[model samples]
Target chain A: MPQLVTVKVNRPDRRPVRVWVPVLPVALVLFPVVVLVVLAAIVACVVFRIGVVRALGAAWRVISALPGARFDIEQGRTAVLVAIR
Target chain B: MTEQRKDILDMLVAGKITAEEAEQLIAALERDQAPATGSLDARPKGKVKYLRVVVDATDNGEPSRVNVRVPLQLLRAGVRLAALVPPQALVKANASLSDSGVPIDLTQLKPEQLEALVEHLDEVTVEVDSPDATVRVFCE
Candidate 1:
């Protein structure tokens, strides 16, 4: 009974699961957003050209109506000459 | 009247006339409406100065950028279609801009938008002083 021996056993450590993780959904969603931005820019350019041309057409009509303001318009271009007051 | 005399009168009105020339101008006005006849043929088409305006696509490739250099008188007319910021309106619109120099930073105005604002802007006209030709820009 006095000859009994006690032995301590070392246990191997276990790794914990990583709970906080980065997801790529935000980046996945950004691709269409960028595409939409490009499309919007294209649309804006078309609208601007139409507006400018329309504005020029309207201006040409008005200038032609003036008595002394010499003007000409063709192929969407205009020229005007008026003596300074 | 001689072109020289007319120019001199213009200089007088422009406040470039010297004190010594005051007596000469007064005497000339009183002496005769006609100027010395010989100087009439000396004028060269009244100095047809040309102003150039170069327009480029804006960084965003939207309205565009228009750069112009003209006789200050023609600047307003040539860019007549380009909107001018009246000092008061400019001040109001560009309230975020610094009070010194020109009111540029605050407006964020595009060249085409400015052109649209002009009351009666003739299309982009490039007058060639070299050969008296004009190149017009059109929207396609």
Candidate 2:
């Protein structure tokens, strides 16, 4: 799981902008809500005849893979970058 | 003087090549020997971690670039998630993909097949270069 995410933007005539977000605290605060969502999801899967274990596993995999991703784009004198760590 | 530089100087002294030509040759050689910028290695040193896509283009004299690095784990996770799709949905997706000229069958995708593909991705690199644009896709 990613603990931090950074975003940067630069424009020709404007001051560059940068932001760093710490994810751990947010994740912690959301833990209870996540648990409830998971429970509801499992129940929904059961009612829908979907495999609960597979659904949970797939969700976990997606979340676990969120770290280490980066995207950067630039045009003319403007640029934007996003990084997960 | 390195051996190659000495050779170039000798050639210049002997008039086999003009001073301007020798200068250009030395400059080219120096550039060839210079340390590369950005990542030092062309290929990842160990297990590949990211799938990278880089694009640089100039249109109407305006330059643009895009760089994306996606974790390989995300690809693995996506493959796993694909398996959970209902067969009916996969069939529809396959038909839609084919209609779009992609010619791929989502129904036939398997985790083992993706693993094999990922293993080979470590050794694969794709590049496209033209006057106005350059693109690269590779795993690193």
Predicted model 2 interface RMSD: 1.4
- How many clashes would you count in candidate 2? 0
The TM-score each candidate achieves on chain A is 0.25, 0.72
| lDDT (10s digit) by residue, model 2, range B27-113 | 998887775643476645687889999999996788999999999888888877767777777788889988999999766777789
TM-score, model 1 to reference? 0.20
Where does model 2 exceed 4 Å of error?
A31-40, B1-45
Tell me the TM-score of model 2: 0.70
Best by lDDT: 2
What ranges in model 1 sit over 4 Å off?
A1-54, A57-85, B1-34, B37-49, B52-78, B83-93, B99-140
Model 2: per-residue Cα lDDT over A1-85, one tens digit each: 8889999999999999999988888778899998899899888777766798998898889888989999999999999999999
lDDT of 1 at B128: 36
Worst 10 residues of 2 chain B by lDDT: B35-44
Candidate 2: clashing pairs of residues: none
Candidate 1 residue pairs in backbone clash: none
